[model samples]
Target: MNTHAMVMALALLISSAHLHAQDTVVIDGAVTDRHGKAVPLCDVIFNPSGFIADDSLYFKCDANGRYRAEIPAGHYNSLYSLDLPQYAKTQLEFWGWNLQLTENQTIDIAFDTIEVYSLAVWASNGGSQSLFAAFRPMHLAAAKLPRLYYKNVDGTPKAIMDISPTLTKSDIQASIDGEPVVLIDFHWSYEHAGQCSAGKDSPFSENEPCYMPMIIAQFHKPKLAPGKHLLRVRIQDHLSKEIGEGVTHFSSNSMGLGF
Candidate 1:
């Protein structure tokens, strides 16, 4: 063969050899604590968002802080993520590469520990609402947090039948269709930086000011039909002497509290 033809023949030989070597693919990863400690009870998914062992990109992490899922020899752009729902947190994960890999190839991954804090608030009415809250002496950051998530007696959250920032007995008793049995569930992101003071030449005017605190509640409930409703928020800031008192009214629709 001529020199050019010889080179073409050599290229074909290399391609043929590579095609026969790939067989099974391996998924490798480690489950570590915040301190790099290996975590047990971890499972990984091998789906399109996971691995290729099952054609889909999903699989579970095996014990020993390791994961290995086999896939056919080919290129795949699967997505991967952990399955932690109760808190609805999922994003950081260890699989689903955007590149191509051959069978029997091993892919390694590592993940960080996830953490969260929980606060429970009971519901009651004495023509108003009541609850206890506390904030200790610690440094606070500046960020908005999810304060509250309201739910129903069946653990289902209900929308505000009506909101009376300035709630009265008559307003509480009135109902749009009949009456709304709704309750407020409280939640918080716990990033406190609620302090801001404008120094000389501050852009803020006398009325516009900055405020930050430990607990700001958000109420996300099922949407209810239109009607008047009474909404109250009881807070307790143990560390802050000024706000550690009775349950305060955070908002209402009647008086257009949060309109």
Candidate 2:
């Protein structure tokens, strides 16, 4: 191609790039706690709808819990806030789903609601962590004893249990469609130990048992007709006298599969 033609091609490429940049929208917001104070250094993630799990946009809020980013305008399957401080006490980490971003907008996050995170049912016997999904369906025949996993944003289970000796399995309550579901066992486990540690004078000893966030409850799977069902779980912290609850919908089919 001639020099002029090459120059024109370059110009066209630049123009296209400019137009693509214009297609982006700015997203800004602040993360606050129940006391209306900023939650600093919180992580925000936006997962594009119907995309791979690794495909996501991440941003971190400033010291005042304010965040801003320019991203391509599109729909998101989920928006999550992670790595929140214990003082936040948010019940849910997943803030929004099926979100559409067409223009610049401000989306503030707050932790005033509840105190649990990642509350969901697992289809396995709770022996291995591989079978865990935030919303995995429960197969009644395969997993007659499905387990519930959740985390307390306020403090670790061991710490709470230390303060409240009376805390027991009865503190956790579950129901399906407003019907009580019998719980068989309750236990606590760490979700991610590598990211947790104890400091000198910390309530934890030697930081040996840190990061025990996951509270598991095993229950008998009830028979259900094919369709959607609502599962509700309520937890009361005996030490703080605070209550946190979570609700999720699962589908049951003839094959005893939960969706």
Candidate 3:
């Protein structure tokens, strides 16, 4: 855990604590893999955007990978993550999205195998913090993604810090049907340097860009045959010296979205 990482995480946690008392919108959804298999007990984190101040919302999926989140009516972003220590780190998948929540909504998110993986370190307390995301494509070129899911050693909910700059195209590689594709064009997003920008540059530096700590990438539903198609993600992080590589098999029904 790096001291700067812990400081940054704490700062983001403090800033996301601004609670609002007003009408709220309810979000109900399921967390499933690309194959429509439920990912139970996963964590879903929500942070509404475009508000004077915002609070972080947390939810947990049941055995069927179903969860409900209540948040103020506003534009919001959510991250879905499942931490199954039993599986290889490279096998884990995480997902995130940005959307408006003016009323009750039902958004189902899907999970894809991890192509690249990263973690932030809290040097002050020696804790490793990371956000992992996965995605499954839908019929209308849309997707089902998971929310940010992480907990403290004390079993308390933790907010994810914006650190998206640490990841680059070079760190990830993907191929569809053996045809290489652009990494940046697939589900990549950054956090703005706002109130969450504190401690992003240096431990106590005043000027620095604060991007969200999570890295999101996805493969949209591509037109393929009705048989098995291969989706591969090769990840190499120069900074962490950690490599994540895996292959996922997806199937299509000619006209339907395949996982």
Candidate 4:
């Protein structure tokens, strides 16, 4: 072979090697919370949009909130998964807990959530009764709040509400503790509100925006403001800040709030 041809062949080989090194590859990543820490025990599952369900295996985040999983081998062009709890859609609390892994790479995820502040709740008429009202968790607001439902005895808990823009909200159904319930749809709010009832036609039209006037009506919230007293526990989310003055009653004998 000619020397010139040999040189050209060597150049081609070098270029091919470089291209191979730069080729895209699958990936594995460790997911953690905002504190740059590890998640100890959260499950991570790959979405089936890329492949068969059995091929998709879930991983758990460790105590430090750190999780690791291999990218599945399949026809997937590229995909990823993070180890975290399923999303809470309300108020943006727990929506983005997971991460996606690209093919042939490692990722370090630092997830963050909105934090809330608060002060002690005091009612003018009551003697600082903190044993009744329950504070909602941040995840609850962050998650997709399923509207309770019961149609046939076997079709109960269908979670009938679908707030997506495409789904019409003209009619809604609810139930509590094996009984029928109703709520009023909101004009511009992400969530529906209304009074809960056990019988038929609501006081207002079924198409009205609201049915249960107060959020506490059918919730069995065990309110302490206007009544005598009842033992209840309130849990506050770190994300909902200062939970307002009279909104949530804290849990346990501890009122430190610790914020």
Measured by lDDT, the strongest candidate is 2
For each candidate, give its TM-score against the true structure: 0.30, 0.41, 0.36, 0.30
Predict model 2's lDDT versus the native.
Answer: 0.56
Each model's lDDT comes to 0.33, 0.56, 0.47, 0.32
Over 1-259, each residue of candidate 2 has an lDDT whose tens digit, in order, gives 9999999999999999988876898988777654567878878887785432777888998988898978888766656664556333333343444455656776656543343444566545334221122321111121222222233654744331111112467766777777888777776554543322345444544434434335667776767667655566655555444444444445567844565
lDDT per residue as tens, model 3, 46-97: 6554222256666788988898887777655434455455233433545343
Candidate 1 structure quality by residue, lDDT tens digits, 37-120: 564555555433333455565455556656666655554544343434411232123323333444353433333312111122
TM-score of decoy 4: 0.30
Clashes of 2: 2
The superposed Cα distance between candidate 2 and the true structure at residue 46, in angstroms, equals: 10
Q: Which stretches of candidate 1 lie over 4 Å from their true place?
A: 1-23, 47-57, 79-96, 113-259
How big is the RMSD of model 1? 23.4
Ranking by TM-score: 2, 3, 1, 4
- Residue lDDT tens for model 4, 1-259: 8999999999999999877655544444455544445645655555434332555555666666555556443333112233335433312111111122324444333333321111122222233222111112222333244333432224432222322211122222222212432332323212234443333633333444421111121122222233221121122333332111111222222332211
Worst ten in a row by lDDT for model 1: 241-250
